[model samples]
Target: MLVLIGGAAGTIAFDLFGRAISPILGFASLNPIGLARGFLGTLGLPNSGAYGHLMHLLFVGLLAYPIGWLFVARPVFSRVLVGLHWAFASAAYGVGLWVFAIGGIAWFAGNPAFLGFAPIAWVALVAHVLYSVVTAATINYIERLQHAR
Candidate 1:
């Protein structure tokens, strides 16, 4: 599914970008997946290593699934309108994820990588935007394929 693909891709992309600036920025690893892992830890799951990261990816992909479903797909040939809708919806959704993850989850989990008043915030903003756009595009592509079939 597009959600699974997009979420995984987004995580990799976000990690890559984060790694690039982290050394110069002296920032901690912006482990978005760890947000979910931390919650599981609090619940006595004690996830670690690849398992924890996989859980995080699955969590992200699952959450993204319904979002992609909600957008659905516009009529075929309405490329511009569909693009506009995807853009708007994805942007809003991305921002919501950023806020929820950074402002809510990270805050509660005591992870310092995603808080405000820092350069990482800016990087995260861009990363999230990229994520949403990719999610939208992937879902749209799948929908178009389904329609063609």
Candidate 2:
């Protein structure tokens, strides 16, 4: 749920920070919605906008769930065992997300040449990191609560 909320925030931020002002800022466009629309086909919709947004949300949840489970939530107590801070681990996971997902797969799968030259790529990377942070925090909270019960 937190991951979804963060994704919504990221989507809004992306549009607000996107190509509308690219003329003033040489690289300001990451169109996940556009990418979804192109990749997923029309889905019987007029322009595929709504379908794309839904798929984008699902993708966000799918991406964050495992990271939250495997990295942050799972290792929170283990960090204490190793004398490390949980936040440090979570942050590392966030950056790892950027390095692997946006920088690697999305770049290669989408337009490597264009992504390398775009500021939106960086913004999208941050968005993914933010999403991961929220997922980590939320899952940690839930785990704590479950234990408290």
Candidate 3:
């Protein structure tokens, strides 16, 4: 469905920024695969590279995160932040994801909390926002197309 497509698009954006753009810009890059692997390790699960790929790409990026955006985040924010644009709200959701996944989960995965507020943490922040923005844009575009039909 469109949701899945949006999610996949966003995930690709996240990876592109984290792996290519951030590093080229002199910031530490994000490795979602490693993070997923470490998180699985923390949970006493398989933590193989294959498993990490599945967890990050299939589960979190393509399913849970998008559902969270459409169901939980948008609804809550629309109510609380009347008149705020969806893109900004999506960016806020990205920040929340960074807090939960990076700040909190990464710690359990053995990285310093918030990367000890290091440069990488800021880079990660931008990546997260980019992910959400792309996701919202994709979904919006799809919906608008459908409505136009």
TM-score of predicted structure 1: 0.68
lDDT tens digits, residues 53-85, model 2? 776656644444444545564466465557655
List RMSD in Å for every model shown: 4.9, 5.5, 0.9
Error of 1 at 147 (Å): 1.7
* Most accurate candidate by lDDT: 3
Alpha-carbon deviation at 113 in model 1, angstroms: 10
Superposition error at 61 for model 2 (Å):
2.3
Minimum summed lDDT over a 10-residue window in model 3 is located at: 120-129
Residue pair clashes in candidate 2: none
Model 3 TM-score, 2 decimals: 0.96
Which candidate achieves the best TM-score against the true structure?
3
Taking the candidates one at a time, how many backbone clashes does each contain? 0, 0, 0
In order of appearance, the predictions have TM-scores of 0.68, 0.59, 0.96
Please list the C-alpha lDDT of all candidates, in the order they appear: 0.61, 0.56, 0.91
lDDT tens string, model 1, 12-39? Answer: 6666666565545676445556666776
